[model samples]
Target: MQKNYEYDAVVVGSGPNGLACAIQLQRSGLSVLLIEGSEQIGGGMRSKEFFPGYLSDVCSAIHPMAAGSPFFSQLPLTDYGLEYINPPVLAAHPFDNGTSASLKSSLYETANGLGIDKGDYLDLMQPIVENWPKLAEDILGPFKIPKELIASLQFGLSAMKSAKWLSNRFKTEEAKALFAGMAAHSFLPLDQLSTAAVGLVLMANGHLKGWPLPKGGSQAIANALLSYFESLGGKVQMGWMVRSYGEIPPAKAVIFDTGPKQLIEIAGDHLPSIYKKKASEVSLRPRRI
Candidate 1:
């Protein structure tokens, strides 16, 4: 007899990216199947009780970028029973000197808080703030030539320069702490240009859109997608990890959301020599370096 299970497309992983891809595919009328390695979904967005009711973010703490995101805005998470708590002051940068500075949803408030440096901060953030959708499209999606990638890089560099300058330009220690705190989000130390850029971009977004947390839990987002996928005649297999082509149901097209290393490891035999060589180079690159 023939096999009992199959799908038009199978997505490996149940992270936000994987679920998003699967949701789109399923909505397109494809017979989609989502396989997740972990028992629960949500990936980096998952929340855990770190100190009993503290509910620390397992990976990503804030949802500032998500709030500003056009992709997410269209998803209508509210309809899926997810409401966001938009904080007035999106983020507060507290210093040991009994002072703190913040980025708020109100641009005027953030500027007023900065005092004299307000103009300088606006100068650095205004363009990106105004063109946030384009900025996000460039960052979150696939790359293409003549894309906003170059413009985005330029924006980052400019923000870094401004942040570094403000570190010295500000008269109040509180102001400097604000800039430094935003920069620290890059996971880089305070002095680096890249780190400075990360901080400024985050602060800029907070001014444009307040940081928020999803109603219920991050898992709600995943559950909604999974529910939608089921509603659209798609099937999902939780706790099923695809280790190779043989492990997946037959499909016309496969969407692998796993990292490049995993893809190459599983599909190396079928890949072109040129592609395989490129993957090898990536594999050789030091993960931490």
Candidate 2:
């Protein structure tokens, strides 16, 4: 006889993704349980006092992606005490010449800092920024037919190029360095293929929605999300580490907010052999190292 399940869904890990998943599941009238391995509910979103009287975020510092996310925008997080603080400058890249190129919320202001390369910067970013809503939806997910085909094609063509190639379009060292810094976040070599893609998306995010930090710390975002989740009657269990599939309670579905290696380790025997092989091949660490 099949055993009865306790929850419709069980989300492992209480990170932003896990919390969001649990909230969505509960909103859809399913009984959801969110579990966290650590004592803290927030995974990377947790904040603590590193220095005396100074709070530091454990993982994520800047929240450009959160500000620009289509799903996050629809959530009533602000009502749950999530306030975002936008800085005057999104980011700054200082050169040896005692000058800095800053990514301002306004595209014109950011381009102005590029000096002679201002026009080129505007030309490269304007169209992408204008269609960021569609581009973000397409690029952030698995391969699919895009809703904005022309915009997606344009972004894909440009993004396929290396960061070095994209930087070459600019005339100033500051502009080049700015692009390089953004692209380097991909953890890939600047000359590697598709490195420009990360830079373009970050740049578009900066222009579309100014990169903002949650007031108090990144924890505020997590707290707000948790508050919202609980309000929807979702349940969370903390300090429960799921080591294997056998440890988890029977559920209709399970969502893991973990790396491929850990996922494979926990569920390898339960998964198809082909999928386990592919998961083992995937690496999150930088390949060039």
Candidate 3:
């Protein structure tokens, strides 16, 4: 006996990952139904009019990850009206004296601005920048044996150090402060181990691709993804909130683009007690406070 399903797959959430998942499923000849809780999709990529006509992004204003993403690079988003605007300076960190340390698209150009730390900066970043493609492929996703063993080893050694430790390598406050500021985006204390990795990756991306903003707004990226998904026959239902597993339409599979907390809430006892307990413990940890 064959079971009939209204959709081959049901994707919860309409964030970039969810949209991509639904799109890929539809492309693979599976009927996908993408449900979004909010009236509009895009989640963090959405933009709204702050004033009468001026539009501002709700979240994720600049996109270094988007520029360097291997998955996003393969998509024909430009055909769907998504345009990326790269600024001349990738990022700027101003000092009290009114001078600034800026990250530039060229490694040499960025190093040149570091004054006394020019050689140190180049020595620290040049190799990683040169081997970025292989390094990114190895580390950006799940753990796997690295194809570029030497490059991954070099990146791993530096990345594992605390940002404070890495800062000591630079003699100049301009270089140190710039690196610290970049690492702060990790939301961890500068002295924490592996925080340096976040800073280094951001700086590496800036040198490789120069952080870009989507033209019009960040929503353009989502809209383009949605347009592309629709072209592949993926159906999206806005304002469809799934409070429980029962709320989802009959589908062979369901994919969640949400955190562990939401997953436990929706699936409940359908998931193993041990699994749910772990998810709850992790979700209820002090970090949420």
Candidate 4:
């Protein structure tokens, strides 16, 4: 069969990870084609005006890991007219009793807000904060077992003991409520083991790097990246969907930013049966939902 299109690489979907991959491939002197099924680009990092001129982030309002995020932080977005702003307090959890506990990006300030459990909170977080660089690298990197994150992972295992463990650690209701509110961000049940790890990590980030949002909107970040990709000679095509291998251009590599199921549906015959079985169990990590 004769192929219809040609490129060194074709990246399906224009999400951050896809864009990043396309940008890097183009930078390395490869001809790259970025295809987006949606009419507009910036998949999940998209923004819209909810009220008149007031723009609201459609999804992922606060970017806690952007600065510590190895992939995003390395992109010189600012040079392309993209900027980020950090609110003084990272995030605040308001309790029913009219009291709120906020993350200040400062250990002492956060501990002071915790009052009675101040000392214990500091003791638990200091080591993590001290090793945040290593923590950031290991957690964000494409490493299954990065050496720097071993201690943090072990610490995380112990921290996974829920609000019940926290109640035993602190004698104050205020402290417990504060931690509880933070843990609820996990979407998992509060008592679930996953809640403990998520809440603790988020709180630690608050005391280390305050939650920041890109100024102008999330699209600005995407535009910056898109500009860079174009600068490196990458071509992006909007409103294009790869339905099968026939739809893909002749290329050495084809990467999909779409769902893994879509990948299987599009290329199942080319892939090993066992590979498709395993991929069926594995969710696409790049997707936000």
Candidate 5:
């Protein structure tokens, strides 16, 4: 007997990734059902007045990555009422000496602000900024040998070294502290590997595209994405929690925008032991890394 199905696909979360996934599926001429655990549409993209008359971003505030994202750059989010406010400076790092270093979209401007480390900053960051267009595809997607190899050595070097090791290249406190602050966003100690890549990529994005803020709140981003998806005939359900595989409406495919725990909890024994074993070792955090 043919099973009664709900949609072509069911997206398990309403976060940025989930919304993007649904939108992509819908764009491909598939009927999609977007389910959100919370009553709110956006997940971490949510913003509220935590304090009276004052609104602050709980997770993502600065968005160099989103502004420069190849995927998002293709979307007509502005038509959905999403607006970005670009600040004059991408980021500013202040020191105890009553001085600060500013990062701007222009390579010369940012490098020039580093004072004694001016040359060093340019030397270290120039390769990254120059090679970004070639590396963006591999860096942002699955790991693979870069399609452009000759210019990727600098990128590989940063990926393998620790931010602390890279900091040794700079003599000035401003340069060291600035890189370290950006590296700290990785939620890893600066002495570890992979952290330098985070800082390097972030710095490169700042030079390529200034980190901009959403006009109203981060929620505007989610709203815009969702609105676009809805226009494509996608269906959404808020405050819906699927406790088990049976709870999920029949769909040809299911895309989980949730954590491993949520996957394990909802799918239960349906998943292979190996997958469950690997997923059990992972951890969950509120924001994307």
Candidate 6:
């Protein structure tokens, strides 16, 4: 809105979140610039070709969360070459004995394979899976009073427990392993409070939209978003690793898709002391992949 500013908005990072934010802003008629540190963007969605002819995902492999996303689902990403390949078996957990438990898009089908825990798994997931569309908005967003009150309350009560506590409901190791595998995606200890929420949300996503892989690898998702953003007149720069606020171009608004450490490092002086103290207190550990 300000002519003196270099751009209406500047987004730091070219990850999915950054791309989505830039795309939305550009769609709303804002002049936006997206910057990425790496030569290639994508962040978690980025892929590497370790072998001569094959590609491997750097961080994330499967994508139930993105595929099932209400916002992403509504986007014209598919039209922009963002094809998702949903394998029949969404996710699986193998045992030492060579037996494995797997999940599918069908709730009843996946539950039936859990042996004795079938009944319990069905009972736990039935309501959540049934109300996924209604719950997606509130569950994936900031805390608020949900329009679907009773359903949200039901999901909240169960989702608030630790993964270990929730796992206790299952008798079979297959069921436990499957659920634990999903919960571990949260990157938190299973005994920690609210860890079950991550597992539940992931599982619900699997049921709603099976864990999918982008047709051309994870990069396709980022490329699709970027292409769509560019279609709306957005601009992007790669390998511009910003070290401080001074390195950034002037803009009316700035949005970061980075960690607390990065934020503090780049804009420490501008940040309030109380906010800086809180940000400094955060100790982010590397993912145990």
Off by over 4 Å in 5: 1-4, 283-289
Model 3: per-residue lDDT, tens digit, 87-192? 8988888989999998888999999999999999999999888999777867988898898888899999999988999999999888998999899988887888
Q: Tell me which of candidates 4 and 6 scores higher on TM-score.
A: 6
Model 4 per-residue lDDT tens digits across residues 77-120: 78887777888887777878898877787888888888888988
Q: Give the clashing pairs for model 3.
A: none
Task: Record all residue pairs in model 2 with backbone atoms less than 3 Å apart, i.e. clashing.
Answer: none
Judged by whole-model lDDT over C-alpha atoms, candidate 4 comes out at 0.77
How many clashes in candidate 1?
2
The per-residue C-alpha lDDT of model 2 at residue 64 equals 90
Cα-based RMSD of the predictions, in order? Answer: 4.1, 1.8, 2.2, 4.1, 2.9, 2.6
Clashing pairs in 6: none
Q: Arrange candidates, best TM-score first.
A: 2, 3, 6, 5, 4, 1
* lDDT agreement with native, every candidate: 0.71, 0.90, 0.89, 0.77, 0.86, 0.90
- For model 3, the superposed segments whose C-alpha errors exceed 4 Å read 283-289
Residue ranges of candidate 1 with Cα displaced over 4 Å: 1-5, 49-56, 145-172, 189-197, 272-277, 280-289
The per-residue C-alpha lDDT of model 4 at residue 192 equals 55
Pick the winner on lDDT between candidates 2 and 5.
2
Q: What is the TM-score of each candidate against the true structure?
A: 0.81, 0.95, 0.94, 0.85, 0.93, 0.94
**Ten-residue region with minimum lDDT total, candidate 5:** 280-289
Q: Please estimate how well model 5 matches the true structure, expressed as its whole-model Cα lDDT.
A: 0.86
User: How much is the lDDT of residue 246 in candidate 4?
Assistant: 82
C-alpha positional error of residue 142 in candidate 3 after TM-score superposition, expressed in Å: 1.6
Off by over 4 Å in 6: 1-3, 285-289
Evaluated against the true structure, the overall lDDT of model 3 is 0.89
RMSD over all Cα atoms, model 1 = 4.1
